[model samples]
Target: MIIIYYKNRFISISESESSTLNSINIEFNKIHDINIEIYKFLANNNIKNLHLFGKNPEKILKKLKKSFNYVKAAGGVVVNENNEILFIKRRGKWDLPKGKKDKGESIQITAIREVSEECGIDPEFILLKNYIDSTWHIYDESTEFILKRTYWYTMKYVGNEELVPQADEDITQAKWFNLHKLEKPLNKTFLNIQYIIELFISQCK
Candidate 1:
């Protein structure tokens, strides 16, 4: 299953039909033909999620993603030796350190560099560079619409360093949160962040 966000509405693509029948349950292949109807449903209705079941969900999703402007980004979920998680308060939400990929830069390095730059921590401080998963989101920025694809990774931090949030980036706070007390911070994050965390844990096994 894949969920793509379009503003406040979400389009969920899956290999099998979901149990709950909705008005917008259609094959992903038919999306292009009835895109206007889908948009109208999203705009006029107050629905939370829309489902599309198909055999080739990934192929359909890839095609649908091209309908808008797309950009790639990378970030990491850094964990300390004590099992605490690194988190940053960015734009008032609890978020991981991540940024857009630099030209000619590898995606792996982009994840390390973004975390280091955003938290004022050294790249070497994070031990593991293993990838986790990628998440997709679409949002409107000012007058323009954007589709952001973020690649997530699982990193380990052993060094003792002070957390610093990049002020110029609207990051107000950076701290290591204890795993047991993650509920508060998790509540302050985007839905994708939670999905990323869950995916990272599953992939680590």
Candidate 2:
């Protein structure tokens, strides 16, 4: 039997079961199964704040030594030519365009691609600047385990083209919000997002 562990759960693939699971190899490939089992184990044991790592004792200890309580992720504060910032109303909240990086893509490319995909604006006329800030948050509901790391960047729009939001992706609308109108609505937005906008405003002054 080949035993694999991740996110605090043990997964065993016996030789007898190998023939039936021909297409699957690594335990990571069975992430959904792993997550389900992890959740079940957690519920059964009434465990919270579980620390997960590889089964190798040394690796596990090393990971725990370097682990953070929260995860890191990335986002963007995009301002257009009118001096207004591009914002998206998503899931009844005002959100900026951003997401996780894809394989073989640079951080800058991730920012530009995410902005274009979420806002339907081409990157050709957008001026992307250095990373503004990074925020850390805990995301537990979506998965049984694993934290995310995100980064945020500031981008300036250079075109006069009309903006269109990607409606199919839960982004209902995208438009520029003036500075005066930006605060109140943004305060009601995601906390990290609000902070990023405030930082951008402060930097401009």
- Residue-wise C-alpha lDDT for candidate 2, range 96-137, written one tens digit per residue: 888778877787888888888888888897788868876533
* Candidate 1 structure lDDT: 0.80
Q: Which stretches of candidate 1 lie over 4 Å from their true place?
A: 6-9, 20-23, 32-38, 41-45, 202-205
- For residues 34-99, write the lDDT of model 1, one tens digit per residue: 456445645655766777788988887776666567789999999998988889997778988898
Estimate the overall C-alpha local distance difference test score of candidate 2. 0.62
In terms of lDDT, which candidate is strongest? 1
lDDT of each: 0.80, 0.62
Among these predictions, the greatest TM-score belongs to 1
List the candidates' TM-scores in order: 0.86, 0.62
Enumerate clash totals for all models, in the order shown.
Answer: 0, 9
Q: How well does candidate 2 score on lDDT at residue 83?
A: 74
Provide the lowest-lDDT 10-residue window in model 2: 15-24
